[model samples]
Target: MAVQENLLLGAKASKNATLTLVFLSILKGVVGFYSGSASLIADAIHTSLDIFTSLAVWIGLKLSMRGSEEKFPYGYYKADNLVSLFVSIIILFSGVELVREALLNIASPVEIKLQGIALGTAVFSVIAMYALSQYKFKVGKQIDSQALIADALHSYTDVFSSLIVAITIIGSLLGVLWLDSAGVLVISLMIFKLGIGMAKDSILTLMDAWLDKDSIERIRQNVGSIQGVKTVDEIRLRKSGLVVFGEIEIEIEGDASLKRVEMLFEEIEKTVKNEVKNLEHLVVNVKPEKISVMKIAVPVLMQEGLHSKVSRHFSKAPYFIFIELENNDIISWDVSENPAAGLEKKKGLKAAEFLKDQGVNVLIAGEIGEAPFHTLRDNFVKLLQMPEEIEDVEQVVKKVSELNTLTAPTE
Candidate 1:
């Protein structure tokens, strides 16, 4: 739906710019011939090139939107780059032609009978071209169309050339005849530089250059924040007309089940697409990391060091002691108050979340409930059950150390 709207608005903007250029071209030609303003006639010729450029932009918008997955898998988006190249060539030729005419006029200075009609026409062209440029620029930004933006810039050059014509008319009346030709020379050089820049950008886009730095960085930050993502491995993006296509690679723990992996993939995709406004599609690749250390969380009734007795219930515990493990040995342990303790309802789910946020890889709970069991499993936190008979923290840790003694939760 959004793509359709962009195409519609883009077509309208480019089409309107083309029609305006045609009107300005005719208006300048008739006025310049009768008034004997050589610079105005040269500007008229430049306006003609603008007509071609605007027309090409309109055509490009139409062709670029003809993307089909079955027919042309990569789409016809490259047509926009082709159109941009064509616009660049037209600008270069027009500038060269105008520059040559300016030099000839300077060599053999011509007398101008500057009439009010000629001056009025030049000023009017300035107003019209400026308005057209603004319109095209706004629409181009909204639709994210590079070709339309280039057309807007072409219209801006028209504004500069028209202003030059007005200045030339004033100079002719002031008897500074050389100023008219000099103004045309300045206008030509300005447009020539613009054409070179546009051509360079078009060539680079054709070569599949990476997206700009700011956009890539924003995507990276957003994707790296997903809960299960251990690392953001790669992000590759390219623009096709107004849309962006991308591939992203991320890392998570090795123990994540298939369902958990799928969930992480979905979240990563959502984050990336939301960060970039023009993203069309993304492929997420998930890799697993070989974890060396894991944490075990046990709900304790007292805050006593190591000897804290186990709580009677999962969420009703007063504190949680996280045991850090490397291989089968205990490396260290620390305890923190359970934020969800003493809750009348939904305690199991909230307590499960608290443990997950603490990076608990394995949980030691003798009286685990059903709701919290599923929650921990979904977060890839392993469940281990020790005998409720041995209640001391040190004794529970010793029992869980022998992997075979601990019973895991099951469906």
Candidate 2:
């Protein structure tokens, strides 16, 4: 959904929660006042605080939807987390107050007025807050709203505290007043722990915690799969409320034209958007990849142009040298009539030296001797074999292109 619509839905949910809490607090307050039960009054106050926190959540969600301005270029996405942290602080204070009140009552031993109405009211509060917490939690998870989640947790603590109040009332009725105080203490500590955890999570988000490893690996795989992308050099992702912001650097072939590079970048962006979820903002930077150029030399016995017939002899007396380049285009052609081509002593070495000196990175020939093979291998030249039946220069080039073992020279 759009940000505005999502925020509107969150506001509606928070408003409904606020109204429910207000009504429940009023009912509990009326019962506590009639019975003069201090525990019941404390629970009522907790519910009223939840109402305020719910309102804070509504305000935060609404404010988070605001667009960026000159003063705040990144928008108000962090407002949601800030409000959540604020609610956690409120919860923490409430826990402390409850603990202090429970300890003082335990120490002084005030007789709690335990009545059927008080117990019934406590039960009702527990059930109501439990239902409200469920609703809030479900909606918060659906929209991925952190403030709503914090508010939901705050409401959840209310349900537990109400349960403790019920126990306190039951213990007072059974003349075991200390159990009520003990339950309150336990409930307060639980709330304190939950509040601290929620606050820590909010602070981490506000500080821009790094994304998980799985997400980084997924980005690398998706971007690396794009055509012309050599590698995904770097990936950085950070969470902002429900959205994710990312920066990536990818490498492509250096010889690509500006138009081709632009198209590749577009493809990378589209692919990432399609594969990743909740990516609100993405910055992709492209770098050119370095690659080594291959220069292939083929000995040809021809009577015509570049596509002429191939020669089967490696140390032939007179041969036409066809140099192939990266795109299978010929760079040059020369008639190599080396006198060492007819020599028996070190003829293969001499021919290999001649080809190497011509700056040939790869040699395509038919039936090269062992001596020339070692020479080519030592000189870091790749060799592909051509059969005698392959008469055309094009056929020799095709054979070399199809060769899989470019690391080792072939006879």
Candidate 3:
């Protein structure tokens, strides 16, 4: 929408330039005919061409502004390029005619009348062309309108060409007859170059060429800066007249949820729109990448015989396990897979006293009831309950240790 608005603004500016040039061309033509000055006549003709080219630009802009249709799905954006190409050809032909006339004048020089009037008109035309060219150039850059830029170039060249003619006319009045024809030749060459440049640019646009490398790189940097985007896989840009359409493919972490990916997409769109002035359309696709998860061992304190019970049901037991001593002191206690029942009561009391003294923070066991759970909780010992039916003490112990690590307090 912003792109469309800018295009409209350019169209309006072009229309105004056309109207002004047409009025100036009529005035110049009347004066040139009365003065019989070839240079003024040539200037009038160039202004007339500008008026015609401006009309072409206005038509092209109007057509390009139309919405997409069934017959032409991409809309009429290329029409502007086509008009610019046609204008370039016309300008080129005008240059060729001017050159031909210049050659003839060089061969058979004629004294032109009203040198003062011709010089004055050329000076006024230069001032007008300069003002109009500056206006078009400024707006063309702002809106990214190639047609407007081409029109501005035409106006700029006219300013130089008219100034050259003015100098030639002044020289002719000073009896330097050859300068007039030489000036025309120089102006012809400049106009030819402008025509060729405009034509080449229009052809490039019609061919759907990509934008500049720097522009693509800037877009890549902007999209990559978005959070959750791991990398940019591919980017494509298509130019239609002044507007640009972009397609971007990005890679993101596989573990990143759908909501996160959506946020990244939104961010990318906003970033592109804000950064690139002529960006008309954008499509974003996200590709996910898989990552490995690492596992680590964690220590946890449990009631004495609790590990034994868990070991009896499950295969694994905690490593570097600690228990309370009989005197309520904490101590590292190791128990084999199968322990004798004779030491059960002593071990349980010792484990409790040791945990109490060491300030063992949490306990994990299988199926502890509310009464015992509350007792552990009141003692400031966090208890985690596991399912009683699951045997395999090794697996249970590993799972309990993993959970404790994840929820453990940091020092």
- Root-mean-square deviation per candidate: 11.2, 12.8, 13.4
> Candidates' TM-scores?
0.70, 0.67, 0.68
Summarize candidate 3's per-residue lDDT along 1-411 as a digit string, tens digits.
475787688889889999989877887788767866566667778889998888888888888888889998778887788888988998998898888878887876667677777788889988999999999899988877788889999999989988987898888888888787788788889999999999998888788877477877888898888767788889888778777778899888645566887788788988887766677778887776632321111122333432433422111223213343332322334433212123534433333334445555555554333443444455556555454464433445445534432132111
Task: Summarize candidate 2's per-residue lDDT along 160-256 as a digit string, tens digits.
Answer: 8899889888888887767666776888888899899999988988888763678678779988988788889998777776666778998886555
Worst 10 contiguous positions by lDDT, candidate 1: 402-411
lDDT of each: 0.82, 0.78, 0.70
**lDDT for predicted candidate 2 compared with the true structure:** 0.78
Which residue pairs in candidate 1 collide? Answer: none
lDDT of 3 at 353: 37
Number of the top candidate by TM-score? 1
Order the candidates by lDDT, highest first.
1, 2, 3
User: Pairing residues by index, what is the TM-score of model 3?
Assistant: 0.68
Among all windows of 10 consecutive residues in model 3, the one with the lowest summed lDDT is 291-300
Runs in model 2 with CA error above 4 Å?
253-277, 292-411
RMSD of 3: 13.4
